[model samples]
Target chain A: MDSTNGSQTLEAQAKAFFDSAPPLQNTHQITQKLDHFIQHSSANGEARRIVCVTSGGTTAPLEQRCVRYVDNFSSGHRGATSTEYFLKAGYAVIFLYRRGSFQPFCRSLPDDPLVECFEPIDELNIQVREAYSEAVKRAIVDHHAAVAGGLLLKLPFNTVFEYLQMLQLIATSMRCLGPCAMFYLAAAVSDFYVPWKDMVEHKIQSGSHILDVQLVQVPKMLSILRKDWAPLAFCVSFKLETDSNILLNKAAAALEKYKMHAVVANELTTRKEHVVFVTSGDNIIVQRDKSHSGNDLENPLIELLSERHAAYIKDSNRQV
Target chain B: MDSTNGSQTLEAQAKAFFDSAPPLQNTHQITQKLDHFIQHSSANGEARRIVCVTSGGTTAPLEQRCVRYVDNFSSGHRGATSTEYFLKAGYAVIFLYRRGSFQPFCRSLPDDPLVECFEPIDELNIQVREAYSEAVKRAIVDHHAAVAGGLLLKLPFNTVFEYLQMLQLIATSMRCLGPCAMFYLAAAVSDFYVPWKDMVEHKIQSGSHILDVQLVQVPKMLSILRKDWAPLAFCVSFKLETDSNILLNKAAAALEKYKMHAVVANELTTRKEHVVFVTSGDNIIVQRDKSHSGNDLENPLIELLSERHAAYIKDSNRQV
Candidate 1:
């Protein structure tokens, strides 16, 4: 191969995967998760209630493999679709969705459905941007191949750890919010990530379990919602389990552990039907099981939850 | 209403729409349409190209509601469905979509396409997240309402200006990206916004004119790209015109004016089919007029462009 061929190959490779961010940590990062709730014993709905739905899935950008570092199976059935339902039911929908899922989301909702599309990670000019989305969009558009190819940018590791760091910044900012709010973490965040130590330089031609990825616990996002971020925002956590009783136990435990008003727990392999127990501090409201026309169980669960939330507000208000 | 009710309602409304950022001039906006060749641009073997799609719809957040905002329409059809074709063809996809359509997106791309979602800014704690999705999960597991609701604690806005300012900050940050890209600007960007003369809050009760909307140019995101951001990115700007010939001419002119590589032009009255003209410094590739199948047009386009780009590198090297 000639010099031209060599350069073309490199450019092709770069086209396939480019490292856009500096090879070092770019700047100070923020934690974007909400803090967990405590035993404030503050009467529920004493303050106002705002529901924030994070609708979409995220992938870790990788340079060498030209494949995703992390992935998920999210239908946004609970977040965006149910969001429209909630909005139609007269809730002012402040829709914070993933930009990549915009089209599909728009298709689900009508032209005007009281919605907002929130992107992420403001740019270098983060101060200029009001939404975290604009920051993320600017970064993606600024470094497409690099980011899409899973190359690490700004932060140190290309793994989910750095991504989590970035997420923390946004989540932290959210946790600082006031009272009587709801932060819906419907996004399918990855359970595991590759430790930086288990990395190979030039694409290890052979795959191996020898690459022992020591998975330290990623920061518990929903738990933090109960602890640090919003002492006031209502926190709802989901437990996707196979064992039936464990699901209920976990759901109840989640409410206690997080000091939350509601804990949503469901069996993942129930086939098309969904039965989620909305375990709250005062009562455990298990929504009746409903099978939908579609094969997915999440949609019906969301439908039940949306109504449950409304009832929660109404009940709280009546008591007051 | 009692004092408690009044205060709670006001707080709820305030929490509903948290922060805002002022709108900056569209100084950074520019449309980069391109022109591709015919004979060379074909879907063949060995050249599987990837296209980073930003679609559906998006709203440019503002500190204040005014004529000075830009929001894109996310019809969701052209990009999302077309994406199905791309996925079937075995090409990797970086799906950037808006929020409301999350269910549709989740429904269609349920397995894995590695998508990221973003919604508009009105929602709470979306901008204030502490760490990442994990932390959020943990937060919900720990606390239900307080921490997240506390995060909803934000400085309320008295006017549209404040809202626009908040939006601008988010927009800039979310879109920081790099090259070899493609942005399908099919989202209807809003040109008009409510205006507030002086500091007085003018409430538009029953009688409000459609013309009352004080229209203003939104920040030119395209213009931003045509200039510095993604130098090598292939930006496809949409031109909705009354005349087909005029649309083509205007598109070609736009390609040159903005130094764009390709342009997707359509007659406003036409349904479904888009007469896409691919233009660049060396070649003007016209994709024959046809109904856009809900599949990936990006790969075929990428295959053509990537090969051409590869060829350009080869030829340029020969001359040297």
Candidate 2:
């Protein structure tokens, strides 16, 4: 199919999916919380720059009862760490993450962190180990401060249906912010999914027969997101590939086709150590600095993105 | 294919898989730890039972580089909680679990637990909140005690390859324990998988086309495990079905075919509320106590399983 036809089909599929899906259980509550957070943060002419950081991975359930699912590989470390940096950079963050993925400020801790860091001082008292006290204190204090100041709002989803709907709600809620709003689409979303209507509602029986699953192309929502949902927001998307030869080309194509402000291109092997930013004009390579042992690539990447966002805001104001 | 041919084919495929896959990083250390735990526990006539509790779900990677995978639905809560009860019953547990799954004694805590349960007393101090302190302390104390005494050994795996390979290693290592060893297979193991030889080595590219994935039936290793690996050990497996019609029948078939000592049958919806234990003699229905508001089904379930294990040990001793 031609690009236009493909895009049209994807958009149609998206509409169909939305129409068929039951509304998320916490839609009203999430809306209320978002409205309260945004209103409170923007009050008194101290409107903080807002960034919606999508993290982790979206799952496509093969069975309606969901005994099995297809999942992308993501720890949500990038988005979680980015949120911390964003908070440090004086921006309000809307963290939309996969359920049970990494949480912001808890990245440095162990997987079962509570079981190790805590201790029974007496019957009613538990103290953090001296070794972990400082780090734990910093994380808790920063997290509590961010929540108390209405600078961070966390929303979690498991399935693809929940993610798309939640994304739409977040975008619409942040539409009033216009140029001050940004989208860091770092989540590793599934590209194909079985439609709910076609799925079986029970555990698939296993015996001698080979199991064959047919997955329809998941509708690309980037175009709709940029064009309709939050047109004036600064948006960035990610393109992860194993082949370096086609990574840049595919990223460029995505940038033009979806009208993304910038697309981050990364290879599977070197994703942790390096990434390339594909903008309209320039291709910038961002690498982890060996000199600073503890610093991550997100620190520099976020700095560059935030600088560009500031310039975009200034330019938009000048146009107005 | 006939059953004989199918079993032969599966064994061949398993052999091929083991040959092709790279060796796990910490095999030597894990084997050493298991040997030490088992030998020490069995020494001085204070022979505590050993149980290798496989918990959580295993993922089947579609790609060789594995950007995407098929995952079974499991949080590893069953395995983790069972480990605690097993420890309480004086059985040393080898917790082979999925990475990032629930840990024993930490089940009652919230998802984003550390952030909420902790308070920064000052710049360098952190303390568990009063409400959560008691629970947190109990968990920490129990976990530490188990670890310090060498009664618990945790081994984490992500993919099906890792889980199966690790299970084989553990089973072989525990063969010396004879009737004193038990296997509690609570993990939601995937039934179908794309073989390593046939898997793509890169991320599957997305376009305007339907994706068809062919998954071969996973080899049923339970029979091989019973006959070859640990013949004298007591093995209990789980059957989680959505439909009530065929649940008991399937469990019975599994018990007979795999030579399993028992099979715990549960419906997906009522798994936490009730389970039926199917054995050679009779099917015993185990239910949660509604009168005792805070009681867990595990309390009774473990008690019954332990009694059976003790009887099996006694019978084996008498035979010897």
Candidate 3:
């Protein structure tokens, strides 16, 4: 197909996906929050850099009432850790995370921190346990500062429908920032979904020995975000594969096809240790500092991305 | 087929299912914990009543590496609330739960209590906020008491494979308790699963426009639990359906087929407000006490079940 026809086909598919989706439960509230956060962050000619860091896994509901769902694999570690780094680097972060996934500044705490890290001092008071006092204090102080200072905005999503719609809203809202906006697409979005209209209202009965489910492909929204929503925004997408052999190739393909500033490629097993930055010029391999016991891969990865974003911003200004 | 032939077929299927499944990661640790807890709870000829309460929803992994999986809908509220009542009724609880699901004594706390309910007092200290001090203190004290007093043994699982395997271990370990042992199967278990041997090792590639997944029935383990694992243990299974029309019939059928002491019939909509206890003799409808706003359906349901269990114990002693 010609380029024009391809773009049109993709546009139609994206439109259909959004048109048929069940409307988000809190679209108005979310949009208002985004607008307020964006305006506050960019207030008084500050021109502060803001990045929307998408995190965790999106679900594909099998039924309209959703007795069952297909979930992508993500603990949201990357996004959470990266959000911390971005905040530390003096950037406002809009954390679009899956509900109940990891949170920024809470990585050092236990999974059930409330139950595990605290004890009742008396009938009316509770105190953090001695062993966890330092970690808990740090997490609370840092998290409070971020949220209170209007430097962080956390939005949660569960289903693919909610994720896509929210992402579009965020991208469009951030478009006003021009090249200062960044899209850190790290969420493990579902590749396929059962359309809302076609889904069964009731839970699928288990009487049948063999169950057959047909899941249609979720529309690719990256092209739309690049071409329409926020063309000047610095975008980075991720490629996670169990097989190392095909990881970089797929990432490179994505970078070219979606016009992403860079594609982060990492094998599933080694993702925590290292990642390859697939860009137009050359592939840059970033790794966690082995000598530093507390170092995370996201630390170095975010640093590199921020540098690239800065360079891109400079180039965009030069063109203007 | 005749009863004997049917039993044989079921046995074979169950065996095949277990044989083909991947081994649990921490079987030895789980078994050791169960043994210690059971022995401690039954120490000094106390003959304490012990109930294995399975909570939350089990996942059915579509791939061996599990980048994506099918998940059942369950907040684990029923199981968690029932556990609190069982503890209050002087029963040791073996909480076999899905990881990250609701926990006993934690129902009243906010979802992210660590962040929401606490504030940093200094660099090395944290205190529960005044608004949440009472709730936090109660939860911490109660949870600590139950865990430290050897009344609650919490074991967590993720997939159906882990849930079933751990359940078998718990049951066989509890077999010596005879009538003192009980099984409260409240988890939303997956009815279908992709066999481990047939699952792809890597994450399923999403290049295809349409993905076709064929899931086979997960073998019914309730019958095996009754006849083989713990013959004398009183088992109360649960039936949760979205359609209230088929709920009672299905619960009754399950009660008869599995020879459960009772089956709790609940609809998705009204589960928090009410449930029906389907037994051999009569059906009892239990509802939350509306006169008291703090009242929960599980409180009355557990009270009734405890009374019936006491009668059952008396009958068993008379027979002995």
| Leading candidate by lDDT | 3
Determine which window of 10 residues in candidate 2 chain B has minimal summed lDDT. Answer: B1-10
Whole-model lDDT per candidate: 0.39, 0.87, 0.91
Residue range B57-130, candidate 1, lDDT tens digits = 44432213221122333355555554444444443334444543332222333221112222223322222222
lDDT of 1 at A28: 44
The candidate 1 chain B region of ten consecutive residues with least summed lDDT is B30-39
| Per-residue lDDT over A221-300 for candidate 1, one digit per residue giving the tens place of the 0 to 100 score | 45545555565455666655545656676667667655766666656455234455566534434443444332334444
Which lDDT value does model 2 have at B43?
Answer: 84
**Model 3 TM-score on a 0 to 1 scale:** 0.97
Docking class of 1: incorrect
- Candidate 1 error regions (>4 Å): A1-49, A60-68, A92-177, A195-204, A207-212, A281-320, B1-320
lDDT of each residue in A1-320, candidate 3, tens digit only? 12344888888878888988999887888889999999999995769999999999999999888889999989999999999999998899999999889999998888788889987676555667889877888888888889988999999999999999999999989999999999999999999998888899998988878889999888888889999999999999999999888898899988988899999998988899999998999999999999979899988889999999999999999999
- Regarding TM-score, does 1 or 3 come out ahead? 3
Q: Report the C-alpha displacement of residue B291, candidate 1, in angstroms.
A: 30
Q: What is the Cα-based lDDT of residue B239 in candidate 2?
A: 94
For model 3, the superposed segments whose C-alpha errors exceed 4 Å read A1-5, A121-125, B1-5, B122-125
